[model samples]
Target: MVRLEKDLLGEREVPATVYYGIHTMRALENFPLTEYKVSPVLIKAIALIKKTAAEVNFELGYLTKEKGQAIAQAADEILNGQWQDQFVVDALQGGAGTSTNMNVNEVLANRAIELLGGQKGNYSLVHPLNDVNMHQSTNDVYPTALRIAAIWLLKPLSEGCAALQEALQAKEAAFAGVIKVGRTEMQDAVPIMLGQEFSAYAGAIARDRWRLHKVEERLRQAALGGTAIGTGINANKKYIFMVNDRVRQYAGIGLARAENMIDVIQNADVFVEVSGLLKALAVNLGKISHDLRLLSSGPRAGLRELRLPERQAGSSIMPGKVNPIIPEAVNQTAFHIMASDMAITMAAQSGQLELNAFMPLIAHHLLGSLKILTNAVHILDEFCVQGLTADEEHCRNLLENSQVSVTALVPHIGYDLASKVARRASEENITIRAAALALAVLPAEKLDAILDPRAMTRPGIAGTPK
Candidate 1:
């Protein structure tokens, strides 16, 4: 069935079976930029806003009890996962997210009209503009809904960081005694416990978790009541206060109206800040993943100091080969998030006065980064970190052969003597331990104590009294 709905442009045919009306139809025609729709998370958040707006309007006598009840009911159904398919506008639309807000308004207005025993598109009963979207503008509503969606996702991202931190800590404990050769600039440096490396990763994640927690405070101040340009034009001041409070109550988040509503509307610095935080997390994750892949490079020709779980075959042609698929996946996710941060940075600054038209771009990349970062943390924890093992004997062998291990005796002997021992070891093609013994740099017992894993890893000069 086809129904005609009128807009400023003229009347257009809308699919009668679907709740979305003329505005949405026009958006679909005008902005077919991508296959992606506005995130369902943002849609659900908008439903909360509309439901609260209706109840407040009814309380303030701006809407008839029946109209308000109908609108609220439609919004309730939407919040509970109804009519998701009716939100048909692409996420990449122009007009500063007006397409999204109008798409939502038209859907609820049509659904409410149906509830009131009126046919869909019969706006005379519950007009999308006059009733369902009473005193609201896309400039205010879209940004507010985006903030709420980001708030919802940030909590899980924080929790994901925490879980990953715990997994790294567990590895720290499990590998505390296993000494490995540390590398600097891709060259062997000195002895370090495998556990210490894991501990550093845990520390970085802990910082990321704290950062995610703190960034939410910036998002808590909203511009909900500041309709169009933050002047609250066409909206009752009392309704503004009431609606903002009610939305906060329904969301169960500590949201407050911005003291300078125009500032929130005009400046998108908070999202840039938040995106930067996410990028920091991505960098750390990328570094850790690359380190793991490098450490687990090969069972024969590579470092082979750490063992990652065998996932799929490394090569279709190579026989009996396994790959570090989990870390590789995490590395890609990190790269995408880093690029998203850059996109978010550009969009944030590209806005002009009064409002940012690039908000849809900001929302797309910011929300995508949050979701993928959270998933990456979880995958790294469950699939890679949990199953990781260290090749202690191989690590020990590498340390024994590495010339840098001779540096452990530098404080006891001297840098000059240490260099001589390293040079002699290289010339003779013998292990550092053998060269040290052959050179009689120190007593065997003393040299052994100096290079002990505990003495090397802990604070203090090895083979020397405190």
Candidate 2:
């Protein structure tokens, strides 16, 4: 079944059973880029805006009550997850998301026509542009919807970060007494408790979670009511003033209309700022994952100080080989997020005057980064960080073998003597403590006092490391 629809360009045939109409049909034929569809969260955000606009227009006497009710109902159905497959426009499209906006507009209009006992493509009954998309433009509506969708995704990412932080903090507490050698530039440097190392991860994740929440405030400013080029062209002043508040009320979000709508619509720096924060998170997660991989390298030959949960086999032919698969997965996810940040940065920088034509690119990378980072954090918490076990005996053996722990006595025995002891131990194939004893650098009791894990892991080493 085909229905005839006409636009300024000409006429096209649309499937009669589909809610989406001619604009979407044209877009489907035009854009055959990435197969990814528009994000459902973004679609829902647009529906929230449409429903709010309909109710506001009806109450303001711009729309007839029946058409308004029918349009609102259609939007509500979309909001409730109906007709999702009808939004067939490629996420990567031209016209600065006009195709996506028109896609939504057409679907809602056709569905509303059905509700009002009119057939699809009956513009006289419920016009897609005249009634459903009244007082909105792709310039204003797309960016506003992007912000709402970004905020909604950010909440879960923040929560996922919080969960990761808590998991790391738990490890910090669990391993507070587990002694280990710290490294700098991939070389053993000094003594540190496992807890202190985990504490650093916890601190970084805590900051990431807080930053995600703070960045949400930046996304709260919406370009809605700004219309085409931010001058609210062809839209009534009453609608311009009332629409944002209604959107906020209906969406239960703290979205506020920008004071300088023109500037807001023109500038794409907000996405760059948000992407920078997400990149920061990626950096930290990458660092932590790298550390996990290093520490859990081998049960027999590698550092073997920290043990990750037994997951999959490391090789197809290897026997009883358990790899740090979860952290490896997290590392890949962080890498992708970092690359996404770069893409988002470039797209944001490429914005021209009046509007950014690269928003689809930014939206794809930004939203994708948010979702993948959230999943990475959650998996790191549940699958890796929580199941981590410290190889205390292995840690102790490494600490005993490395001369780095000798640096703890530099305050009393001096650096020159410590170096001599380290060299003597290396040359003689003996422990630093034994070399120190043979050199008579200090009494055995005094050497043991400084070498104690508690004393070695703290500042101003001495009794109880206070």
Which is the leading candidate under lDDT?
A: 1
Per-residue alpha-carbon lDDT of candidate 2 for residues 90-150, written as tens digits (9 for 90 to 100): 8888888899999999999999999999999999999999998998898999899999999
Q: Write the per-residue lDDT of candidate 1 for residues 84-169, one digit (tens) a residue.
A: 99988998989999989988999999999999999988999998888878888888888888899999999999999999999999
How well does candidate 1 score on lDDT at residue 407? 77
**Can you give the TM-score per candidate against the true fold?**
0.97, 0.97
Tell me each candidate's RMSD, in Å, in order. 1.3, 1.4
Report the Cα lDDT for residue 381, model 1. 93
